[model samples]
Target: MEDLDVVAWIQVSDGRMLAVRSRGRDLLYLPGGKREPGEDDWSALSREVREELDLELDEATFRELGVVRAPAHDQPRHAHVRMACFTAAYRGAMAATGEVDEYRYVGRRERHLLAPAAQAALDLADRHGLLA
Candidate 1:
């Protein structure tokens, strides 16, 4: 089995986390994407968030939220995704950009509408007393 390495942003306001849906996809997810070769977590996540949200992530304010290993969607059955999630301060207005077409804030109860990795991330948040 192979692991898909991904980075995700977990921005919560009033107990709801930021969620996004990419173009041509049905599942909603947290901001961020697969990490490219040679990129550290900060750089990779920053690049992804910039592309998806048109906002610049402040590396200095990054705080790891959690990591989740979940079944990979649209991949081989044996493949899984390891998503490292974080919370960070950012600059610029938040807008759906690049591959992202929709953005919303979601609570734990909305987990059923999220992608697998995002669902796990939200579970982690709830475990940490973040959403409740």
Candidate 2:
């Protein structure tokens, strides 16, 4: 088994966060993907968001949310994932770009719908008052 390192874009609006359902996964997660080797955080995030949601994020609007360590999706508990999460502003319409099957904006009340790691990250954003 190979370990996967992922970078996620956390889009917040009106105290809500964005999550997307993967093509074959049951649980929804933050919109992101595994980073390509040698790619920096900003580059990977931009590419992943474009690939997953067809949204291009403005680099200038990017804000570092935080990192979270949790069990890898569909993987064993011992296998952990280190997610480097970020928040950014975009001007395009939000839609699934085939990589994702569906999209949803999760507010604090709906945070339970997110995966544990994603929920933790969301909590951090809430504490910081980043969800505007």
Runs in model 2 deviating more than 4 A are: 1-3, 76-78
lDDT of 2 by residue, 1-132 (tens): 445567888887767888898888877798887778899899998988888888889999897878887767665633777788898888688789866999988888877677776877787778878775
lDDT of each residue in 1-132, candidate 1, tens digit only: 769888999988898889999888888988998778899999999999999999998878999988999988765654788999998989999999999999999996788889888889988888877785
Give TM-scores for every candidate, taking all chains together and pairing residue i with residue i.
0.93, 0.88
Which residue pairs in candidate 1 collide?
Answer: none
Clashes of each: 0, 1
Count clashing residue pairs in model 1: 0
Show model 1 residue runs off by greater than 4 Å: 76-78
How displaced is residue 39 in candidate 2, in Å?
0.6
Judged by whole-model lDDT over C-alpha atoms, candidate 2 comes out at: 0.81
Candidate 1: C-alpha RMSD to true structure equals: 1.4
